[model samples]
Target: MAKKLIAESAAAPESFEQAMAELAQLVTQMEAGQLPLEASVAAYARGSELVRYCAAQLEKVESQVKVLEGDMLKPFAADGAGEGMQ
Candidate 1:
């Protein structure tokens, strides 16, 4: 079980979207209560790893956005008219 989790985490998704899709699938499987105890534990561990990876990716993107915005993070406008817009 540990080996499988390690392998899966090592592979890690290439993109945040891919990771999120896999995590969603894992959540659905776990919620169904069909997996045995060991399998469930493994899935939980993998899901945790995915969560961390997704968060890190988000933070990286946010940092890039801040840099593009001159280090000033602005609130997004719901109507799509925000900073840098005429």
Candidate 2:
């Protein structure tokens, strides 16, 4: 039963936000030290999957942004214009 639950949770999240939320919840549960050893191990595995999913999503977005910018990704200028742009 526990294995089944863990396997179901291991499914990929619908989006990055969902993955992050699930990962945070898992961390909280693990930190509380309430789960049995087997459950804790399962949670750790699921957390790893979430982390990978989030990273892949971020990477995909970044690549898309780079292409949109003509593959010229530059440092962000909070002031809207850097000194050299003048």
Candidate 3:
């Protein structure tokens, strides 16, 4: 089973895509450096939250893959593969 990755995705757009989008926006804000110290701190906090969300999602998928293919998962690799190539 693929574990229905879509279930949580629809409920929380905050899945990987949304988290990465927010993280990118946060990076732009930090790079601009126009915000005040307090604002910067706030941005950093929000970014950290997104980081945690992304990490947790990755962990969940990792666990699912493990359950799906135990030892076989380790042998599968896509070291240089690009998106939409498959």
lDDT for each residue of candidate 1 in 1-26, tens digit (9 for 90 to 100): 43364456657789999999988888
TM-score, one value per model: 0.78, 0.80, 0.68
- Residue 71, candidate 3: alpha-carbon lDDT: 34
13-47 per-residue lDDT for model 3 (tens digits): 44698888867877787798776776677677777
**Model 3 bad stretches (over 4 Å):** 1-13, 77-86
Candidates in order have lDDT scores of 0.83, 0.85, 0.67
Question: Which digits, one per residue and each the tens of the lDDT, describe model 2 over residues 1-86?
Answer: 54565677777799999899889888988898878899989999999989989999999999999999999887787666676876
Alpha-carbon RMSD, each predicted model = 5.1, 4.3, 11.2
* lDDT score at residue 49, model 1, on the 0-100 scale: 89
Largest TM-score belongs to which candidate?
2
TM-score of 3: 0.68
